[model samples]
Target: MNLEVLSQHMNLISLVVLAVVVAIGFIKKINIGFFSIGAAFILGLAGQMSAKDISKGFSSSMFVTLVGVTFFFGMASQNGTLDLFSKKIVALVGKRTYLIPILMFALSAFISAIGPGHIAAGILMTTFAVYLAFELDINPMATALYAKLGANAGCASTLSMTGILAKNLSEPLGYTGFGTHLFLTTLLSGFVFTLILYIYYKGYKVKGDNPLKLSDIPAFNRDQKITVAAIVIMVVACIGFKLDTGLFAFVAAAVLILLGCADEKKAIKSIPWGTLMLICGVGVLVNVIDKLGGITLVSDFLSSHMNQSTAAPIMAATSGILSWVSSTTGVVMPTLYPICDNIVKTFGSNVSYVELISAVTATSFAAAISPLSTGGAIIMSSYSAAKETTTDEMNKMFKTLFLLSVMNVVINVIMAALGVFNLGHLFY
Candidate 1:
């Protein structure tokens, strides 16, 4: 075999083996970060690389940053910030039961925009939705779906921590400053999705006679308070200091620990360490796939479709399909952001950054119905099963989510074309 051909074959073999390892790891429910790091080490050896080179991927700044931010979030949750929000949210929305979906979507959007993971937002909103459901005697599944859909929509719309995956995808295509564009489109799209969800759940009577008051919720310890305060300051610092967000998260987490508010033991105990590990592992697999030319195949396929006149509808429709299988923000933003920017620059259209970015972010609101999607699946599984509920009601609630998700996507596509509510300019 030719030397170049041999190298390509070796790389392909490594990719295949890496995929198998990841599959096995997922099956065993292993920590993804550790598994990925281990897989990288094994691949390096198989590919005749030094140990040092393989270890480099494990010590990535991104992973470290995520670890810190996650720790901080855990501490915040432990200290009662999430619980407090849930109590207040339930109380505020209880009187406006009809507007729960809209309220949930708005809150989910803001929270997802700030947090690094949509899963965190989903958990927070879902908890609150459950409380509201019990308080208002509404369907828990419907409320949960509302919260999950809202978080999914918001995740697609922002350039915040949760939207990092999308931002990473946009960078390679020369779409610098995509955050601004994504923020605007996401805001408009979120509003549209919220409206659709509200309409779908309309006329359903909820019946809670005596709900627990806010004081009934559990209290937090002092450590939790310090952690929450640190997180709030960290968020402000991300904007005020113009620091890399991951770095800010790490510093804030470290500060909280150093102040005796929380220690490494407490921090580790607070987070879903397993989930963090899994995401880290997924990140490694993604890196390896990119290195093995998988990204080229995907990128070429997308670049082939970059168009100005049809960008809105094409992206909206295509994202709806892919997002059911993956995160709309995760899959769509990387390719679409650049394509939109290139199309705008190429056409010499006067479409401002705001217009271009909002169109790109609107993709997520449309993808929330796919069972394969992270947020969608969580919503579906959480609310789909009830001990005493009829099968018919369960099916109806699910059908409602599917229809609402589609409507949200359609509305987002229209708004994207119309050039309204660019989040990128508002926050970024």
Candidate 2:
């Protein structure tokens, strides 16, 4: 319990070093690459890792997993598939002001389940909602609110990049099927949350055009049409659920490029390489820090010291906070999963690992809705300033997003408590 004794643990020291590196990375406004690499090297030395092992910390495999997937999302965007999809949705909802938020939820949930990340889904949906606003003749704030709602709903689904917190929760809970369960539970949650939004924002009046007519919409550009087709095929592939989601995205992206929907130049420009690199860097660094600092060892030791029954809430809260700070599920999962696993082992209770994993996954995904949360920040940043609308309208849009996020978190926590989709096992 003493500070001196805790200081001796490699995981503890590694964590301290990681915290410092992250702080510096933020201050510099650069990728966390240096911090990650530094953490990896220091942890390697402290954990008695060899040069080869340390080198593996920056492995291409990790980059392929993160960056490759991201590029594909970018490729899809470049191809105009997203635009076309949004256009079609807008065409369907045209001047039906009340139905906008409802459609936002449905479209976002389905699209994000197969997209690169939840933020991608959020951005696409929000942008589309803006276009819809133009069609409906609504103020920017209402359009922006629907967009924010789409982002939140879409991000909550199983395909969400943010949803990977389940994987981490699985490792700690000793739950091998956590991913499967979390995926299902999240889908249901998405629908429920969407319904809530739809009901809350019902009955706005606006009559301008017919609600349904595909023939009235113009065809997309040739290249854009191709991209749209490719996205559809990729979505089908993902729903078939045969391969790794990341791999699926990578392949889809490559196919889009090969088909001339997005060339190499376009693909490179489309993707968010900065964010991908940052995640990869932080991910490897966090692993190294854990190894060198023996933070896990200390967690294990303390877990051993506590009543197993009482640690569940603490673990859940910790996972939620960590997920919020790190943003990437990849960065947070590896760091937390092992600790959860240790707790499960120490407790030896009837609670399955999947339950623990599901609990954490549900809560962690919910965290993204907070204004300071990663998904929230991304969505807010993607909001283009409205030239036609007043600044007051834009401010109102931001407030709507904040309100939407609070609703999402409240719904998720309530669902978790109600054992909706067996989430109660997280604490029980």
Q: When superposed on Cα atoms, how far off is each prediction in RMSD?
A: 5.3, 4.7
CA lDDT scores, all candidates in order:
0.57, 0.59
Residue 238 lDDT in candidate 2? 55
- Each candidate structure's TM-score, on Cα atoms with residue i matched to residue i, is 0.72, 0.78
Q: For residues 130-237, could you state the per-residue lDDT of candidate 1 as single tens digits? A: 666766677676677667666665664332544455555455545555564565455556556656555665623544543645566555567766665775676677
Superposed by TM-score, candidate 2 places the C-alpha of residue 200 at a distance from the truth, in angstroms, of: 4.6
The true-versus-predicted C-alpha distance at residue 243 of model 1, in Å, is: 2.2
Model 2 per-residue lDDT tens digits across residues 1-428: 66456546766677667777756664565666655776687667767778676765454544555566567767767666676666677567654546665666667766776655666676777666655555556543444444554554454333445444344334333454444556666556555655664456442554445344567666787777776676677656655654565676677767766776776777777666666666567666755655564546756775865564445445555556655555535454555556666666777764344554555555565565555565555455545532454678557656766666556656666655455646554523
Listed per model in order, the count of residue pairs whose N, CA or C atoms clash below 3 Å is 13, 12
* Candidate 2 root-mean-square deviation in Å: 4.7
